[model samples]
Structures are given as C-alpha cells and as structure tokens.
Target chain A: MLAFRKVVEKMEGYVPGEQPQEKGFIKLNTNENPYPPPREVLKALQEKVTPERLALYPPPLSDQLRFKLSEVYGVPPDQIIVGNGSDELLNIIFRAFLGYRSRVAYLYPTYTLYRTLATIQEADYLEIPFQGEDFQQLPSRFLAEEADLKVVCNPNSPTGTFIPMEEIEKLLQSSRCPVVLDEAYVDFAEESALPLLPKYPHLIIVRTLSKSFSLAGLRIGFLFAHSEVVKGLLKLKDSYNVNILSQIAGVAALEGLNQVKENISKIKRTREWFSQALKSLGFQVLPSQANFVFVRSRSYESLEKVYQELKSRKILVRFFPEWKEWLRITIGKDQEMQILLENLKEILGKEWNQGA
Target chain B: MLAFRKVVEKMEGYVPGEQPQEKGFIKLNTNENPYPPPREVLKALQEKVTPERLALYPPPLSDQLRFKLSEVYGVPPDQIIVGNGSDELLNIIFRAFLGYRSRVAYLYPTYTLYRTLATIQEADYLEIPFQGEDFQQLPSRFLAEEADLKVVCNPNSPTGTFIPMEEIEKLLQSSRCPVVLDEAYVDFAEESALPLLPKYPHLIIVRTLSKSFSLAGLRIGFLFAHSEVVKGLLKLKDSYNVNILSQIAGVAALEGLNQVKENISKIKRTREWFSQALKSLGFQVLPSQANFVFVRSRSYESLEKVYQELKSRKILVRFFPEWKEWLRITIGKDQEMQILLENLKEILGKEWNQGA
Candidate 1:
C-alpha cells in the first residue's frame, strides 16, 4: 500500500533524545539548558504580539535577525544563514550537496542525526570510528581525503569531547570537499571554528541557540560559511523555514548576550562539579567541554541497571545501547544534580565504593 | 569555489510573492488575511513566554497541536502532522516520495512553489496546462498513468479557481500515484477533499492557518493523511520542524475557531463585492472561491501597465509574468478595496470604461 522511495521505506527516522511527558522528572535526557533565556526574549514576544505584526509575512530571508547575528558573531550578514533549528540547516546542506551516489563522512556515534540524514538522501556514508574513548578524529585515514562532505561535530554529542581547532583546520586545508564544523555545543568549548571561516572558504560552522542562548524550544540555529555556500543553502531552504517568533526571539536573545554568557558559565561550573561527583561514585568520566559529561562505570550491565534505576527514581539521563557501559548526563541545576547524586547513591547502596 | 549539486547550482530559488519592506501600500499581493487571527493566539504567547517553556526542545511530534487540529478537523490525532508551515510538510513529502529521475505532475501556473520543489528533488515534472480560463484539470491525459506523485491545488493560487470534489475523486481513483490536495486556500471554497480521506488511502490534504486564520507570520500548517503516510513523513521531517511558540499559538488559534470563521466570512463577503466591482470596471473576473479574484483586462500590456500604475499609487496586487494578461488581487477591507478602486479609476481615466 505504501509507495515511498526505497530509502524512506527502509530508513527509521532520527529519534531525538526522549522528552518524558511527566513533570516530576529531573529532565536531562536532552541537552537542554537548565535555566531560562534572557528576559529580552520573553519581552520581545510580549511587545511584538500585536495584531498588525502577526498578520503579515515575516521578512523572507530573516534580514533583521541575520543582521543582528552578523553584529554579534562578527561575520558579514551574507556569510550566515539561519534555520528553524540546526536540523533544518543540516537537511538543506544535505539536499544541496548530496545527490545520487554522493559520499558523506563523519565520526561514528557523533550526532546520530547525520547518519539518518545521509540515509534519507540515499547517499553512501563512511562512519569513521573514533580511535579511543577520547573520540579523536583519524583525519589522515578518512575525512580529509575521501567523501564529498565532511561533518565534524566539535564538542560532539553524547561524548561531549571537543575536537581542536588545528585539527579542523588541517581537515579543511587538506580535504577536496567542504567541511562542516557542527559547533552546536561549542559555546562551552575552548574556541570556535568561526574564527577559521576567513581562512577556509569551504569550512561551514553551525551553531545553535538551543544550548547557549536557552532557546531550544524557540528553534533557532545559524551557520557561518563563505558567501557562496550561504547562497547555495538559501536555494535549498524553505523560504520561511524560521518563523516570525523565532526571528524576534533570536534577535532579543542576541541582544541579551551578557545574560547568556552568565548562564553558560553557570552550566560549565555545574558540568565540572557533576563530572567530579560522577567520578567519586566509581564512574570514569571523560573530560567534557560541553554542558554534558560522558561516563562509563565498572561494567556494562551495571551501567544499564543504573540508567533504569535512575529512571524509576524520576531522573532521566541518556544511555546508548550500542555504547553499553557509557551514559551521557546533561548538567542540570545544582539542586537537580544533588537529587541525581542522592538517587544514584541510594540505587548503589554501600557497594558504590566496591566499583560495581 | 562552489561545489553544489547540479540541480541546486543550475536552478533559481523560489522567490516568494514580494513582501514590500516599507509597508504603506494596501498589501494584497500574497493573499494574506487583512484581519488578525484569534485573540487567543496573542494571549497564549503572552502567558506561555516563560523562561522554562522556551528553553527545552519542543514536543518533537507536536502532539498537543496535532490533538487540537484533530479536534477541529474531525480527523484522528494520528492522521495529523504539523509543520513549520505547510511548506515544510510539502518539502518532506517531496523527499519521501521522489528520488532521482522520479516524475511529478501538477497544474500549470498553480502554486509556483511546487515546481521549485520538484527541481530541488531533481525530479522530472509534467506541467499540465489547465483547460481554458476556469483552470479545470485535464484528468485523462497524463497525471494518472505517468507520474509517481500528483499535486492538486484546490482553490488554486493566482486564479482562485477550485477543482470540484467529484473531479478530484475521479482522478484519485484512476491514479496509481499518491495525490496531494493542497488546501491552503480551501477554507473559503465550497467543499474539501477531507471527507475523501477514509475512502482514498493515498490521498493527502494540506491546510494552513496563513490565509483564513490570519496567522501567516506564525507559520502553522498541517496535513491530513492516512496514519501510515504521516509515519513516513515523520521519518523524513526534521525532529522539531514546528517551534514551541508556533505550537502554543496554534493551539490557542484552534481554540478560538469562532474568530477565524468570522474573519473568513468577512473576506468571502468582500471577495464577492470586489469581484463585481472589477467586472463593472472592464475587467474579466474569474469566478473565485478564495479570498482573491483573478482578473484580466482588454490587453496583456494594459494589464501589465495597470499593475505598475497600481504599485505607483501605493497599492499592490500580484502580477505573474507567465500569466501575462492576469492579476491576482487579494480581497482587502472595504476601505482598502475602496482605495484600490479609486486608484484604478484614476490610473485608467475614462479609458478603463472603454475596456482598455
């Protein structure tokens, strides 16, 4: 009865990190900010909700928001393009670049969404596995020389490991194809690929308001690339992909950068504290630059058991079956982290010091 | 320095109907509702604009908005899928259904966006010209036998003419392909293909809040299809295609259905009056089932010249280069219509009465 394209029929859609319906859970499965965005975001919505403003079509290219983003990011307005979310921008990039028999390469177990997008495009993909627990890119072996597009998720998801700027530069300089630095979590990292844009024309860096700006629900994402790359993506994107509310809220969020920086600093502080706490609980935690920490305990089965026990106690942290022993825990507020620690201690009993 | 897909590089992007930046003109070009959406839309935004609400990922599937849509449309919640707009839904449909070398069929000079979508998909398309000025579909020739996907725009754009339900049924019955009835303008039309859903599993009807609901800026559109079709689209769509504010505002808009109906009634009433006035003033007005009238004057050049004259006098209506002799005039408020009439009379002078 179904006549969808072969790829679509065979492929499972990208499953997002679960968002539990109940309110009592310490919701950390998704890497959403524990705090709210700047008051200006809310203020913008309140002031801009007039009948006249909501009646007309939004500026098609989001010119005002782009101009504001330009001022904040120090990139020319033409070099940036925004999307409903970075997901939409990724979809556009895939559509504009990948065709029949196109090859894409990214690190395995990075953002799983890349694999799903490649599958949807029917593109051949090379998932280069990271060398070790550090999730390091084996640049010489694959991405720099092969594939039509190379995706590097700086401060990669789940792992929360940040790849260095020099490594990204080497890939951009050596690669025949365009390289995308998905810096969705880079606001918490040491530096950004945005600084490398002027030197590397083929380098595209994507950032999201979902994390640093605390506007995940508002669905605002932007990419910085050469003007030609931006022009090509504009051709593929839905004209009104980003709505009027997102544009207004995004502008306000940018305008209140000081508030966002404070929130980021708080989250970073919380991340460091949470990592130490997890280590104290007999878990080996990776040094994380993003808002989340990746950890593995003494055994795979025990790690799996801890995830279930935490869920039963109304704590939601991410677990990957493929990784088996590892858990990606988003850093919530200090109180939420304390509750998580208490629950984990209760689940372990006195055996926590026995390292399994 | 550019490396883009051939289809993307060679094709010009879809240019949306001109949204004049400086907005003093009686803006009628895009068929936007002259009235506002329900007061509840604004009220919801004001109440829901908390820090916590805008910080998390939106409900990935938009379950709450879909539930409300289901209640209003009498469709099952499982059968509805909300999009950033119906535009995003169309993009998903194209991606899921079409592949390289796939063929698509649509009416000529319908929503111009469809052809652009087909180009982006790199699919071959057949543009079947409508029979005569009434823009009737030619069912027997090509659509059923040849194309993999069939698109029917009901209460079609520019012309504002609708294909009858029975005609649509006949086409759906005969076609082996999936048929999408884009009902973006259907709220003002006589009948909808919605009732045909149970009978034809391959049929999809797309609707938007942009026109009748006066929520153009908010970008909420949904499709009614078989649950399986929705499942396929869900796989192809970005996880959070619809943002949180649009979801909240859409739910509130649905709650205020009475206000939407009243606005629709006013536009329909104005459409009838305005069509008659144009007819009396030497323009051949097509029978409209939408909020706009498709008109033609004595000569193609004269019609073109009239558009320019109207623009010069701070009035705006859509002019299509391909449909050279025609103008799509959106029905505005009585006062705006009066101004349009006065300006047209002034531009044409006594010559307008002489049919030129």
Candidate 2:
C-alpha cells in the first residue's frame, strides 16, 4: 500500500452538495442563485476568450481584479487577495496560521468544510456550538478560546441565521488568533464585517461572487484583510490562483452591481413570501438573511418522508441528516417555489389523511 | 503582532518569472508557448460561456475534461484527476504524501517551486544534484535516499535536458515511496513515462496544458496515477478547483491535438535552429529536448552584460543569478528568434571590440 499521509489516509474528504448529472430537476440543494449573472458578465467573458490571450499566463496576483475590487469595495489593493473561491482562501488561512497539530476554533455546524480542512492539516479544532434557538448568538466561550485560527460564517450555512456586527467585533477584539469572518452570503444579509477590518488587525473577511452575483460557475472569491495579513496569506496561495476568464467575469460582475441588487431584492421578496406560506402549513421557518431557508416541521419521520417525496417529484432541496426535522431549501424563482409549495401541500395533506 | 505559523513566517514565497505589465517586449521569459492555441479551443469557450451556465457551479472534479482526457490518452477515468494547473497538482502531492517534517526528495536545479512547496509544508527535503556536466542523468543517491515522496522533472526546466525512460524506470523500481514524474515539459520531449503506470502503482505522472497546449492563462492540468492515489489527492483539492471555461478549454484543446502537434513540431525546429545559431556565436548550448534552449558563455560578467543589453533592446530572456554563465531563452516563432540572434551578434561584437 502507498504510504499516504496519516491525516489524508484517515480523514474523509469534504463532500460538497450533490450536483445531479441528469437534467430537469429543480436544483436547490446547493443554494445556487436562482437568476443568471448580468448580461455584461457574459459579454466580458466572450470578449476575453481568444487564442492569443489564452496562450499567456494570467497575472500572478490577479491585480486587475484586485484594483476593481478596491474601487468597488473601498478596500486598498494591497489589502485584497483573489482566490479560486472563498474555499481556497479558507484553505490558505489554515495553511498560513495552523501548523501541524495547531489549534483552530469555529462554530459547530457553520460550514462542515472547515473541520475537513483542519483534519487535512492535522490540526486540532474546537467546535463551539452556537447559542439560542434560532442560532443567532455566538457561543459564550468563542471569544475566550485560545487557538491559532478561528472562523465565523455570517448568515451561517444550513441555518441561514445572521449575527450582528457588534458581536463579531467583540470576538475580534478579544481573540488573539486570526478571525476569519466568512461573508459568502453577506451580500443578501443586513451588513458586513468588512468595515471592521480597519480596527481589527486580525480580522480576515472573505467574500464570494457565487451567491448574489450569480457567478458560482466561475469560481471567483475575494479575501480582504490588513496588508500584513494579506502579504502572509499571499505566500500560501497558488501562484496563478485565479484564471483570466474568472478575473474578467469578476470585474464585470462587480460593475453590474445594479442588476445584482435587483436580483437580490426579488429573491428576498420570494423568500419572505415562501416562509409565510410554509408557516401557514404549520412548519417553523427561520428568518433567513441568505438565499436559502431552514425549515423545521413537527415530526422527523414526516420531514424525511417529505424529503423523499420531493426528490421523487424532481424538486431538489438540501436535507442534512445531522439536523433532523430540518430541511434547507434554496429560494428559486417565484414560480418554481410556487410549484414546490403546491407539491408540499399535497404531500402533507396525504400524510395527514393517512394519520386520520 | 498576529501569530503566523513558524514555517510560513520563515518561508519566502516562490517568485515566478517576471510578467511585465507593459506591452511591446519580445517576451520569452516564462516559457509560455509562442503560438496561440487552436481556434477550435476558443470556439468551444465561446459556445460554453452563457449567462445561465455561469450561474451554476462547474462540475466539481472536472468530469467532462477527464472523460475527454481519458479518451485521448487512453488512461482509465478513475486514474485521471484534473487540477487548476500542474502546479496545483504538485501542491496536492506534497500535501497528500509529505506531512509536516516528512521527507521529500528531488534534484537540485530542477523546479525551484518544489523547494518553495517543501518550505510551505514545513517538510524536510533532500536535493540531490543532477549528475555530470550535461544534467542528462539522475543523481547517484536519488534512488537509495529514503523519502516520503520523490519528484523527477523529465526534460527538466532551465537545463532543457531529457533523461531516458530506462533511467526513470530504474528509479521507479528502486524507490519505495511515491514517485512523482512531473512532465510539464514532456510534451516537447521524445518519450513519456505514462506507459509505466501499470507496473508501478506508486508512479504519478503530472502533465499540463500550459506549456504545449498554450492554455497557460486557462490553468488546466492533469494528474494520472493509480485510482487510490487519485482518491487521496482529491481529498486535499478544493471542491471546484477548475472553473467552467477552463474545463471547456481543456476538452477542446485535447480535441485539437492535430493543430497542437503541428505547433510543437515548429517549436522543436526553431529550438534546434536557435541552439545551432547560439553555438555559432561561441555560446555553449545544451542539447535541448524541450521547447527552450539553455546557453552558457565563458564569462558570467559578460552574460550579465548581455542580459542587460538585451533588455534595453526590448527582448526578454531569463537570467538566473545562481546559474551565472547560463541564460535560458524560450524558443519563439522563427522571426522572433531571428531578431534575438541579430541583437545578440551586435552585443557580442561590440563587447569584443571594447575588450581588444
């Protein structure tokens, strides 16, 4: 047998949300944006794809995109770094701060990929469970835990709940390690921790173009931090992390912010409408600041049956076995959600009649 | 001060060949293909770039490209893993086999990025010097050295020397650890070690589209190995490592092999003609199997002077301080090489007159 590293040999790989190969199913499991990216983004991609241009290596640090990001986000060019995705930035953070068996801490059930990265690095991690019923407040010990790195995914995944900026600042103030505030879904949320970067030297804010910008297929993300932190993280990233097409797509996506804002507003409206509709059917829906919602019903068995029936009927929504009775469903187009609600009512109604 | 890992704090980042931002230079520094990729590749990219397609995530493992690669190269689909570039594949290999303080072995003066990666991982490495004057043979102790991983760059960089397949097989036969055969430049060489995979489960061959296929800006690469090895490396890779446009570009590049072969043959012809031209000018040129030629002069000072003079004349070639008397020049189109030769003769004649 090949002698693979013990960490790699023993640890399970991070399984991303299933991307079904076959067509025609409503793909809501991965929380992908319901709308396509702005027309300008596609136009930019078309303009950039040429034989001569593709023959050269991309700019080492994606400087053009960084400059564009600096202009749009008000972050200094030196303070920003582009990555393959926020996933790559997270991996870089772990590699830069956490050596073998180094300590990392994050909230339990935020992004499972964090635990997988820690395991890959052979680093120890402390998962502090989020406090309160709606998963809003940070864990009491989160600020006090001593670790090399910490991660906070605002508008946390699978739950879609947001934490206030003040709470994030408190943790940043008290923590000695680099606190990564993952803002992957922050475009749809109330506020961002990016403004906190000036005050917190240890704060690393990561953003992605996948959600609100509707360029998930492009795999572009940004990390904003102090110049010193950015410099150190830069040492750990792949030399040509971002490709030419991605850099162009990112610039165009940022330029088309007006279109993105319209999409976000429509999704938010649909989210509220769908949440209330689910509540009418006697299911508890969390107030979400993300593109998706976390829904809980009265019975775990019935929820499982609902998940199975939805799958069979060609509606794809995320079902986490760890969070029993809870189903995370992405808010697609209004009409798609309407079809989903109609199908859900029939399934629940049939189950209720069977119970009677 | 924020605490970064000791390894990251002490390590220097890998400095890739300078990519000048300004235009209008001869541009032969980074070893990028002088010829543009096939028109079909760009057509494929244009066809793939749609607003709706850009909204969803790319296939996580680049399955379509892998299928195409398997069909073209006859490697089993399970044995092939696609990466952002062969550089990312190299990083994955380091992460998978060499944990913290684990040993990695490679030849000196091969790819400097190997050393940078070792430093980043905080792993110990043994650099065995290339044997003899021509660097056509592996180091004597290379096979016997105990290491967690070993890397061999066939048609090695900077030197442009090729080691025979028999020699590579000998190393593979003797080494107990995973042997990484980095064939980034192998497309320009005589033979490949790909057929040796069935006999040696520990052999991993890494190839790139950057050098030969001229998709350097797209960042597409492949790693062919045992299925088990691919599985372990997959655990360490980012979920969506290769983006959408790159996947399409790779598939189309493979389909356009006829055009690529014609380009490769032209480059080889230019490489030979350039080597002979430099030799006629009294510069010692290595017998190159790769797309570039390495030339050594009698004096390091004169070589430095030549490098500076060439830069002033708007021609760019790589000059490594460590390889004092030697300058590595990428073989460009015939007209570009003619211009370089014309300039070189003038500089040498001027220097000879001044010395006399």
Report lDDT (CA) for all predictions. Answer: 0.86, 0.89
Model 2 chain A: lowest-lDDT 10 consecutive positions: A297-306
What stretches of model 1 exceed 4 Å from their correct place?
A136-138, A350-356, B350-356
DockQ of model 1 vs. true complex: 0.82
True contacts kept of 2: 0.85
Instruction: State candidate 2's DockQ.
Output: 0.84
lDDT of 1 by residue, A1-356 (tens): 65899989989888887877678889988899998899898898888768876778888888889999999889999999988899988888888888888989988778888988888888988988777767755547764557789898889887898778777777877797888888999999889888788988888889899998889998999999999889888988887778888999999999999988999999999988888988898889988899898888764454777888889888999987768778899988999999999988787774543555
Candidate 1 is graded, for docking, as: high
List TM-score per model, in order. 0.97, 0.98
Model 2, span B18-45: residue lDDT tens: 7777888898888899999987898887
Q: Record all residue pairs in model 1 with backbone atoms less than 3 Å apart, i.e. clashing.
A: none
Q: Write the per-residue lDDT of candidate 2 for residues A1-356, one digit (tens) a residue.
A: 79999879998899887887789988888889989898889888888667767888899899889999999999999999999989999999988888777999999777889998898888998999988888888887998998999999998998899999889988988898899999999988999998888998999999999999998888999999999998888888888888888988899888899999999999999999999999999888988999999998865443666787899999988887777678999999999999999999898878743542
